[model samples]
Target: MSLEGLNMLWQLVAAVFAGLGAAGVGLILRQLSGKRLPRWIVPALGGLGMIGYQIHYEYAWFDYKQAQLPASAEVVSTETDRMFWRPWTYIVPLTTGFTVLDQSNLVTQEAGEDRLVEFILYRFERQHTDMVSHQTYLLNCDAREMVPLSGDNREPRYAELRHVEGSTPLFQAVCPNA
Candidate 1:
């Protein structure tokens, strides 16, 4: 199984345990009150606990993954969204994904007036199953342009080439002197 599969399985297991613990607390409360509390309170509390755990996990996932990255990885950008289904996000947007640039993998080349830097960009997204994807890119420091490179020959995809702003973290990280 993939790491994402294992993580999902662990989440399910943890949610079940949370429900069970909350139900146990409800039972204790009932007992302490001489059974005056309604029996429905036990299941209600269990459901609440399961939902609470899921919400906490979703909100904390970004920070948890960020902490696990190596020092060489720099977060270039983050994606946040507010979905209608996730109404709480309207109050505070949820971080659904992020892009990272690995400084350790950067390869710089100087040819006359042009300074070219090659690096890999890693993208991580949260979904039903967490997804991670990477692509190699070539950047021109002087022109502030970036293009994705193809396999083996490192052919640049001019169709996808785009100008990068100097103020962006990606540009700043790759072309510090520029």
Candidate 2:
């Protein structure tokens, strides 16, 4: 789905959550206003409820997006950053959500008699240019490395090719799934 569409969906969900939260607060205010509770406490509780709903949606945003992704999609990269809160003094008041640092579609290639499959993830940030590299190997379930390849950045051209022989063409197709 398009980014704009996903964003609109999230906005709608957040609105529903916010409305429910505010309505709950209003109900509680009506119940406690005549009792021992002070009149100022009603608005304070409502404000806190709204803030709580906002925080909940913010933290769940990443998970909601991930759940909507296609099964074939692979999350090759992720990032999280710290955020600050002023008045809300609950725990550290810091929140985190995964930024889809990078994603890729698994492509299978046929080279001569051998088959080459690669998961190529590309990240385009707001910056003019950025690069990333990783070391990959076809290992077994026991965590033994096989035909390890050095990390290489994808710039003007793909770095180097390192191939290892195995009993079958599909070697590293194990639990980890890389």
Candidate 3:
């Protein structure tokens, strides 16, 4: 899948989790308060918490991804700003937010003792009626060349290249601002 697809999937997952959280909170509230709190408030709080977690994950996602990598791996470059969403609100006109790692695609090459990996970042913009999205890949590793391995819908999915011997180090530059 493309990075945009991944971002949308993650957003949907987050929203679902948020909905569940809200319902759970409501359930707890109902159990605690016999009179029952306002019907909307519980859901509102849950939504807020869910969005907050999703935003936090969006910003910290790179770090999380990097931590999963090996210590010898070098991030040559990065991509950013690939997906986004806006939900309606009573107090405001629209609430704009973003999703990232849209393509979830990477290219890796070898450089002697070190391995280089390239990451592609996708971006999406929202208008009143439509969403505009695009993609850019970053050669963010020590490797000189990265080749795409597989993809569909004109989007490169997996890539293969040479990697430096034992260069899979824990990635620190997981997320790069496109």
Candidate 4:
């Protein structure tokens, strides 16, 4: 299995242990105090702790990936959103999605007399159900501008051309050939 798959498996195992540990503590407390604690309370507290840990892990996922990335890899942009089930997400925003670019793949291409940096875009999502998408682009090295190309047609599409800005770090890194 891939490293990511292993990481996910470990996270789940840790969560189970955390839940069990919390439940054990609750049982011990009840016995020491000689109080008439409900049996359901231990499992309930464990369930709550497990859910909290899962939320924290999900929210910090971006940072975890970043930490695993190589020095040459950088996060270009990020997208955040909230879900109805995760109400606390509104306060501590979760990185629901993001784009990353590795400078190692930078390439130079000639567009007639002009030299352009061409690279691929890698989009990442927090949800396992979603798949990463790759799109191609060409950057004018001197102008610090870029235009997206159609993956199927292998041609430039004018609809998404723009200047290099703080939001375009992925372009800056992957298209450094320009």
| Highest-lDDT candidate | 1
lDDT of each: 0.95, 0.46, 0.50, 0.78
Pick the winner on TM-score between candidates 1 and 2. Answer: 1
TM-score, every prediction: 0.91, 0.48, 0.38, 0.75
Please give, for residues 151-178, the per-residue lDDT of candidate 3 as tens digits.
4443433455333322322233442321
Residue 129's lDDT in candidate 4: 45
How far does residue 175 in candidate 1 sit from its true spot (Å)? 1.2
Candidate 4 residues lying further than 4 Å off, grouped into runs, are: 1-13, 36-40, 109-115, 141-144, 151-154, 163-168, 171-178
Top candidate on TM-score is 1
lDDT by residue for model 2 (28-131), tens: 76677665566666566667666777666655645665685566544433555444443442443323322231223334445564444444333322111222
TM-score of 1: 0.91
> Which segments of candidate 3 are over 4 A away from where they belong?
1-7, 74-178
What is the alpha-carbon lDDT for the whole of candidate 3? Answer: 0.50
- Higher TM-score: candidate 2 or 4? 4
lDDT of 1 by residue, 75-112 (tens): 99999999998788999899999999999999999978
lDDT rank order: 1, 4, 3, 2
Worst 10 residues of 1 by lDDT: 1-10
Residue 96, candidate 3: alpha-carbon lDDT: 35
Worst 10 residues of 4 by lDDT: 166-175
Per-candidate alpha-carbon RMSD to the true structure: 1.6, 8.6, 11.8, 3.7
Model 1: how far residue 118 lies from native, Å: 0.8
Clash pairs (backbone) in predicted model 1: none
